[model samples]
Target chain A: MNEADILAVIRDELARLAPEIAFETLDPALDLREQVDLDSMDFLNLLTALHQRLGVDIPDADAAKLASLASLVAYLARKGAAPPP
Target chain B: MPSLGADMEAGALVEWLVKPGQAVKRGDIVAVVETQKGAIEIEIFEAGTVERLLAEPGATVPVGAPLAMIRTEGEPAQAQAIPPPVDRPPPAAPTLAPAAPPSVTHPSPAGRVRISPAARRLAAERGLDLAALTGTGPGGAIQLADLPAAPPAAPAAAPFDFSQMRAAIAAAMSRSKHEIPHYYLSDTVEITAARDWLAAANAERPPETRLLMGALFVKATALAARAYPEFNGFFENGAFRPSAAVHVGMAIALRGGGLAAPAIHDTADLSLETLMAQMRDLVGRVRAGRFRSSEIADPTLTVSSLGDRGVEALFGVIYPPQVAIVGFGKVVERPWVVDGAIGPRPVVGLTLAADHRVSDGHRGALFLAEVGRRLQTPESL
Candidate 1:
């Protein structure tokens, strides 16, 4: 529903995909893939996590639309799905 | 017979894939052997009828030990199934031990190699080709006694060897570095088109059926190798022998430790989707410790990709026998300069390590460039 909520959902899923990545110290402006140890498989999983968490189905064509943390949060907020605390 | 790895002195015949009276063909797996890497399905070399299974499944035999009696085109099979008097009676047949597979280090002495783990590890570190060294262990098995002990823990080279595998890799890589004159080449390929194409292609497919970058690399390398014969063949006996079909070896790092570069047969013939499926299957089988001897032995060219990890470029050593090895680095979005313009584009660093004895740097550079060119047009690959 909001920027903070979308960020929380994406961050939770990314952390689940890559446990070694410290989300608390992560820079949202940087490329999420380069910031963590995420590969193509992990990336696909991250999209799945976002879909399940925020109910935002990201089409493959729209992958570039949500590549960074800000873009993912903005994309989810646009979808109008409120994230649970 | 199969050399599972460089340190493999001999393999234990775990099971027979083909029985007597079976019609066999070249490349048919006739037997399964337990090697250091795990069980490898040994392939038959000639077309024939398996007249007799010479070695029992439990026997740990030498590298060149005959495992079967095949009746070639003109040769006739014996009316009786009984085999001729052999030097050693076939060892006690053992059932396939999939539940608890034993390592080849402690193979049975009955017509099989009986080298100790320590001796095998030591011989590997000393760079003595086990196939060349005569075994002096139990029943002529090579042992630590046979190989002169380490030189009182050498000052620099002294360290407790990790595994027989690490030593084997060290031996093979050292040989590659010393003997083969390797020439290196690297090119940063723009993979934006390939990545975009793959995303669009996988959009319709199920999550489980999606493609990975490995498939694209294999397909691209296969196409390039077809154009450059020097990079797609065995460099041996001071001569280069080119293979017509593309059997690209994909290097996969095992979950626990070592590496296996198994061949994906007929890579050029497969579609992108099919290539992806094959890659997934190969990676699964390799991680699960299942490798076909022919697949491991028959790679005309190798592709080692540190997929989505570490540095921007990798300069690799050509696997011995294979004249060339293609290396792929992580594909990431970078500030790529286009036609007088700059923008973020998906870029992948491609490197080729080729045997200088077979080809010079000029041809190797062209081969890398051709691979990049093919990747640029992902649909064609």
Candidate 2:
């Protein structure tokens, strides 16, 4: 899948997890935590949602790496390409 | 009968988890009560044999009305607690735990309906009569998974509306603001230590098992509540009765435009990890229209965090009979001073709306300060 496809998948999963978040207007460069109204539980659910929708495991060790939307979208593209076994 | 909330004067009995002749211990969920918000599983505070189920299912009873006739331990014990025969190995052992219903000798709910938790919920929501339905689950039990395909379709459900729910919430919040003499206090605490600790802790966990800042706020507020009794208890009849246990309620907005702040019983006693797990389950079930009766009834204090939307602070009104409510706002980087130097630091606004009858401004300030101090030392929490 392309980068936009990966980002779309992430956005869909996030919508289900936290309906209050406005995905369309979020700045890609801003941290997801700051850009949208989400708690730690919401963040955890986002990661879980992505895992369930797409067979990829974003372990807790990489939390900071996935902070911003750009980072999350890019990392997800790579994970979607070569998913962890 | 337990008071589910400030707005709730009475509730309809939905289902009884226990029955007459059943021996129950403290903290056991005895029944489910239907309020305006939804079904709340009621808990028995005193351990006893249920003499009778006073309030039948579907009956609307007042808050203080007796739902069950409980015979305490001090009373003559008809139900004997027999010690296990240590040396003898029986062919099969009977499980006494309430959760493991299948392992019991007679895992029946007496003459009452024996429906699974999920089925019971669905039945309630769909306005189906479970008593009229047949069970296909193990030991004639009703499971949600199988029940949908068990038999003929249930009659069309009553059209539940959002307007009625909105009215109920408005009534409760309006009553709180009207009667309670509220005093407000706010403090900004630097959560760099707490935030750093949480990130480090999450790095060691799987993504699915990470902790949240809300959990830390809950635990910290609970610890502070223990020291400052003024901010943790119910107010009634022009007198303040302090609660011994710290059951902190997390205010969760419902999917259908209502609010439910159910208690996480004994918050002061729970570790940070356990509290996080409990909050997750509570939030999930609440939104899914499932709440335990104890959670609805036993909150000494309520906590709300409005940080997700970049809100700087939330000054919430006290939900009376409960005298106090705590709120946390957005955690943002600000210019903070440390050791006569200013630099960027992560800070959160902690605000308390407490009853004037219970304490004054000085005491409230101290309670908020204690919460800040607790957050500073995350290791202790």
- The candidate that wins on lDDT is 2
Query: How many steric clashes between backbone atoms does each model show?
Result: 3, 5
lDDT of 1 by residue, B102-149 (tens): 444332222334454445445654565566667775457676557753
TM-score of chain A of each: 0.84, 0.81
Docking class of 2: acceptable
Model 2: per-residue Cα lDDT over B1-381, one tens digit each: 566655555667766787688888876667766666666666666777887777777677765666777788788754332211111111111121111101111112334676766567666555567777888875577766555432222232222234545655676667677777888998899999998998788776766677888889999999999999988887776678898999998988654366778889899999998998899888877766677766766688999976345588899877667889999997889999999999999999999999888889999999999999999999999
TM-score quality measure for candidate 2: 0.74
Shift in Å, residue A46, candidate 2: 2.8
lDDT of 2 by residue, A4-82 (tens): 7778777776655455556788899988876665556677777866665566777777765788889987887777633
| Off by more than 4 A, model 2 | A1-39, A52-55, A59-74, A80-85, B18-25, B46-56, B68-161
